[model samples]
Structure formats: structure tokens, C-alpha cells
Target: MNIQHFAAFRAVMMTGTVSGAAEILGRSQPAVSRLLDRLEAELGLALFERRKGLITPTPQAHRLLDEVERAYVSLDSLKNLASRLAKGQGNQVSVAVLPALGLSFMPRVIAKFRQDWPETKVSLNVRMSPTVEEWVAGQQVDFGFAEMPVRRSGFETEIFSNAPYVAAVPSGHELADRSCLMPEDLREGPLISWTPFVAARHLLDQVLVTSGVRIEALCETSLSGAAFEMVKQGLGIAIVDPYTAVLQADERIRLIPFRPAIPFNLALLRPEFRGSPPTVDHMLSFARDLRDDVLARVPT
Candidate 1:
């Protein structure tokens, strides 16, 4: 039950010999052997077999090793965390973002944040809105940028932008001449769309029903980039957030505002329990400036 005994056993299991384990532990071979003997006695199990100066783990040792390694992994993570704290690198910010913002907007925010706080460590993860919300609730991240209306109750949510959705089409498509499109305009042809049940898709569905316009969806995708690619391939036209349109706007793709404006809103999610880390406020200041710049340039 002693931690030292477990350490000795883990070292022997990893190194395959008492002498090798001794070298790793900075102890004599005989001392490591004694630790192993004590561990085996306490556990009432034969952990290894020694023969011809070679050591081999017994079946019981292999079974115990699974749990041992799992524990050590947690310990190693704690050690790394402590090392970071000791080095004054604990003023870190971790953010989770949905694909659209992560791809288009976050890089600008991160770059500006780094310019002001070069010593701060920043980590960004691109995930689905639900995953981002879960990370915020779990305190696994300092902040999350995701589609708005996150269902969880304990987080502070702030709408970052509420631009209208835009239509993505192949650059030379017939509709490219128009500055904006109505649902009826898109209803005529095959459309690339989000699958039913997606938050944005659900909202769009209600609008379609209300407008008496049914989209002839040829293909559905979860990622904005994928939908944009499908549109570029002439598969179909797609309605997407302005942020994605801004990132993917190119000679191959044309973005036009969608009429009646399905508001493409994104928000920041931060847990109530953790309170905002000071680094989060600093990061958000940079993010707010970037959001304003992006909003001004993207299609209305």
C-alpha cells in the first residue's frame, strides 16, 4: 500500500530487471528487490519470476499494471501542471470554439492576444457547439465560442455577433448576379444544407415552413467548409453563417446575403463556477475587437 513500493514495482515492470529499475530510481538493485518483495507480500501475489538473472512479470503483474499505468498517467499530468505553475506559466487560457469561428475568427484574436501578452500560454480547440458547451460546464476550458442558445443553465453566455446568414454559390452561378437571395430563390435548385436537428438548420426549417418555401436539399453536411466545398463543386447552393462566408470567400465562391435574414448568432460561454480567469478577460478584449472587425467586413 506504500506509494514507494508501487513506484518500485512500476519501474521493474517497465525496465524488466532490478538493476535497470535501480538505475531509474537511483537506488541499489538489492533495495529495489526489497521493495518489490514487500509489495508482493502486501498484495499477497507473485508479481514476477526471477530466473538466470532475468526478471519476467507474472500474469498477476500484467493485470495490476493496467491500473498502475492509469494512475501514473494522472500523476504525470499533475506533475506537468505543477511544473507549469512553478514556472509562472500558469496564467494560461484554454478556449473551445465551433468550426466556423475557430477557422475564421479565432486566429486573429489569438494573434492579437499574443502581441499583448506574449508570456501567456493559449490553447484553442475546434469542436461542435455541444462539445464546447460541455467543456465550459466542466471547467475544462476558460471560454468557449459556439452557436448561441447553449441549453445549459450555469454558464454566462454573451452573443458575440448576430449577422444575417448568407448564401454561398459557385462564382459564376446564375444567382451570383444578385446581392441577396430569398428562400424561394434557393428553393428552385438543389441546396447544400445542415442536417435536420442541427440548431441552425432547425431555425432555418421554421423559416422555410413559414415562407412556404421548401429547399430541395441534394446533400447535407455538418461543417460549413464542407458545405462551401459542395457549393463550389456545383452540387448545390448553401446558406451559411457570414463568418464562414468571410473565411471561404474566394474566386471559386461568392457570398450573397439571404433575404429575411436568419440571424447567424454566435456566443461566448463561460462557466459560473470557475468565474472568469483574469486571462479570459484579457483574451476577450482582443476577441471583441476582432469580432467587430469581422462583423463590419462580412455580408450583412
Candidate 2:
């Protein structure tokens, strides 16, 4: 009939008497008997036989007990799983990230996160900013890091990093000696630039136009990391996000602050329909710390 009836049946079978079952269940003997009676009426099967104030389990009762015991085992396992998940143990955290951060910044964050939560697994998806936003909006991942001005509807965002872009110049280039590079300065050399379709590229173009600077385009790339690679090969100088500059800078390349500060804004996006788990919160804390550390080292 109900959990109480099943419980009574189980206890009586275990103890071999209604009085013993009542003692175990904190119920009166008559109450236990009534539970058994209701259970039998509901199932249309007799679960126990009683005579001269003694009770014995029916054959059907033993079969029902086996099923109930199996159900209880499964319920116990589900409870244990819930407890582990609440404690942030043995779970997976999925995150989508822009290529700029994924190539450099996020790996460090994940390394630090793993030190603290070794049992938690992480799935990192590296994609373009728009794709990262789409994954978050679609709930394909737990959360995402993308360039700001996310245009998706199904996710909430928090500003993760707000820092100015920097110029990555070959170490042998004359502009590398300058304290900072302005849009006008880039006109002196072939410039490795973002593709015209990227939002940051449009912003860079506006700044260049405002500064009355026109530079030769050496090549075009969609990824800041790719631009950094081009700079390292002495192809040309590139204006890149600070995260990429900070991690990918080498002896072959020099990082200089970019004037008119094209701010590279990054946001963290989480699905509105999903709740933040402890694992996600811990990972976010690590990511924020790394962001602050990198920003602090950004060329001013």
C-alpha cells in the first residue's frame, strides 16, 4: 500500500512476529498488523499466515521481499551518488573557451584546479568566441569563456577579464624598442591582423581610421594565437589579446602596450536553466585567480 506497509512486511519477515516488528518499527503490534492487512488487501495476496498468536511468512512474501531488497539497494546507491556529487567528488566539469584563452590561459587554470580537486574530471572545448557562446546558450557545456558582448539568450554572463590588447612584435623590429605602440606606429610595417569578420577586427579598424593610420596587411588570421605565431616567425607585428601575448611571448617576440586601448573584454557564460555545481564554482575561482595574475603581468 505504501512504504510503511512494505517496511512492516520486511520487518515482520525478518523478526518472525508482528510484536517484534512493532518493536523494531516503533509502532504498536496492532498497528503493524493493520499495515500487513492493508498491504495484503492492496496486492490481493496474503503475505503472512497467523495462528495461535504466531506468524509465518507466505511463499509470496519471500519473493516480494527479494524485489523490495533490490529496490532498497538501488535507492541506497542513488543516495550515495547524490552525496558524492554534492561534495564535488567523482564528477565531470565541462567548459567551452575561446581559442585565445584555450591556447594559453585556461590550461594553467585547469592545472591548478586539478591540484585541488583531483577526483573531478574536466572536459575542455576550444572554439571561437561565437561558438563558445552558442555552446553555452545551447547547454552543451556547463559554462564557457568568450569575448564579451555575448549575443546569446539562454545564458547569463559575468565579466571575467577586462584588459587592453597588446602588440606582439618581432624582437628585431624597430617598434619593439618603443614603450608603447599606437595605431599610427603600426603603419610602418606589414601588419598581421584579424579577419574582417571578427568584432575585434572591426574595432581595430575604427581605431586605425580614427588615428588616420593605414597599414599594409601581411596576412589575416582568426585566432590571436595564430597571430602570435606569425609574429614569432618575423612575418609581421600583430595586435593581440593580452592573454595570448602574456603566455605566447618568447625571446623572438616582444610585447608592448597598445595605445587607444582596444579593450579585450572576456565574459563567463553559464546556462540559465542549469545550476552551478561545486566543481564549476571551484574551477571558476581558479580561472579568476589566473586571470588576475596574467592581467597583472600585462605590458602597461
Candidate 3:
């Protein structure tokens, strides 16, 4: 029997009369009786005993009612879960981010996200850009933020930021007084640079080469956060993404625009294979706001 049959059976058992069941089910008394008959025949058990004008449930009906009630309870719970999910109240979200954004920018986004979705847990994975791209391509996380030029096939990517890289100089340094820095300006002091593997480093190298500027690096790091730390210690100045330079800028560091702009591009990656939940979309909204705020505050 189908759900109508089960519904009739439940209604009849609850009310103890076909007329009462009919009223509850918005069907005629004979329609409800027929449903009970079909259900009993399908189950191969007499569910009710009929008297001249009344009905009494059999022991078999009582036993079957227990299972039906449990099933209905489970169905109700499933409906509730679907409702919550549709409203963007999912349990948790997993995100992978490059260190440039993860160090400061992403934290602010998460903080703003929590204000609206405090109950949803957030799992933040801070990795290198390549690792972030791999995680997104492999569907290991719900979404990711990474450097641009993701070659993987299983991602829906959007360019989050395409601002120029900025020169990060230590406070009191000779170059700190310069409002903007060119490739040639780096020659005056030691330069802290990204390792050759980084995509931004390749772009910066292209600009330096095109301008016929070259300088030996005092040190190299794979992470912009580390580069910022090195710059903080007066070790050397660095050219870093605008996000990292703006957020990490403090009394110890100065941010200057880089000439012949080497564009620092960041991308937002979502797994092509998975449906994005409401929480993921909300988190992305927060990220967009943070990107706009940082870009607005960046020095020219």
C-alpha cells in the first residue's frame, strides 16, 4: 500500500472510527474504509474488526501502528533537516586559503561570518597556493582562495583580487620615504623575495627583467606572512600581494606602490563536483566584502 493507505490506517487507529478518520484525512468515510481494506489486504493481516456501526483495532493493527509512528517520526526529522539546510543553517564549512589571505584577511571574514552564523563550525586550512588549488580541484574542501592561474579542471574560479603588488619596507629604511618604488629602487638594499616556485614571484621577476633591473635576494620565503616577518625584522624589503601588505602593515612596516605594476591576482575556487551550501555562499560574501575593504584602503 502507498502513503495514503498508511495515512488512512494511522488516522483510523487514532480516532477509532472511519467517520472520524475521514474527517481527519479530508476524505469520505467509505474512501477511508477502502484505504484500510487495501492496506490490510497488502499486509496480509486484519487490521480492524467492524461492528454494526463502530470499529475496533486488532492486535496486528496495534503492532503495525508502532512501526508506522516511528517511520513518521523519522520523516518529520528529515523534513526539518531539509528545511534548515535550505535556510543556510548547515552544520559546518571547510575552506582552504593561501597564507597571504589566511594570515589576516580570511580571519576577518570568518569573524564577520560568525556574527551571522555563530552555530556553524568553520574549518580553515591555511596552505600554500598550490596546495589550496589542489584541495579545491580534488574537492577536499567546500571552497578555497588561492593565487590566480589555477589550471585544474574541476573548479569554478573567480578572480577575487587583481591589484598590483606593493613594496613592503621596514620603518626607518631609506626606501620607506619613497611614495612609490620601481624595480631599480630595490638595488639600494637587500630584497626579501618569494621563492621561484610562487606564481607571484614569476610575475615580479618578469617585470624586473623587462625593466632591466636585477638584485640579489638577501633571503627567500614561500609565504607572504614570513616575508612580512622578515621585513619587520629589518632583514630586507619585500614585494608582496596588496592584501598581505595592507593587512600586515603596522608601525614597523611601510607600504609603497610598485611601479610598472606586477599584478597580484587571487582567485576564489569552488569545487565543480559539489553543490555549494548556503554557508559557503555566505562565507564568500564575507570574503568579497573584506577584499573590497582592503582594496579601498590600499595606498593608491
Candidate 3 per-residue lDDT over residues 1-300, each given as its tens digit: 499999999998888789988999999999998898899889899888888887888998899998787667547545655776998965777889988888898889999999999998787889887778877886767899887787676898988889988889988899899889989999976899989888878888888899899878979998888898899999988988888888877899999888888887788898897998898899998898888989997876
For model 1, how does the per-residue alpha-carbon lDDT over 1-300 read when each residue is reduced to its tens digit? 798999999999889889999999999999999999999999999998989888899999999997787577547546756889998777778889999888877887888889888988788889899878877876667889888777776688988888888889787788888888888888655888898757889887888889998766879988887888888788878988877787667788888888788887788888787867767898899888877776787775
| Candidate 3: worst-modelled 10 consecutive residues by lDDT | 72-81
Best by lDDT: 2
Rank by lDDT (best first): 2, 3, 1
The residue pairs that clash in candidate 3, if any, are: none
What lDDT does model 1 reach?
0.83
| Stronger candidate by lDDT (1 vs 2) | 2
Output the lDDT of residue 242, model 1: 78
In candidate 1 the C-alpha lDDT for residue 284 amounts to 93
Task: Give the poorly placed runs of model 2, Cα more than 4 Å off.
Answer: 1-90
Error of 1 at 122 (Å): 1.3
Q: Estimate each model's TM-score.
A: 0.72, 0.70, 0.69
Candidate 2 TM-score, true structure as reference: 0.70
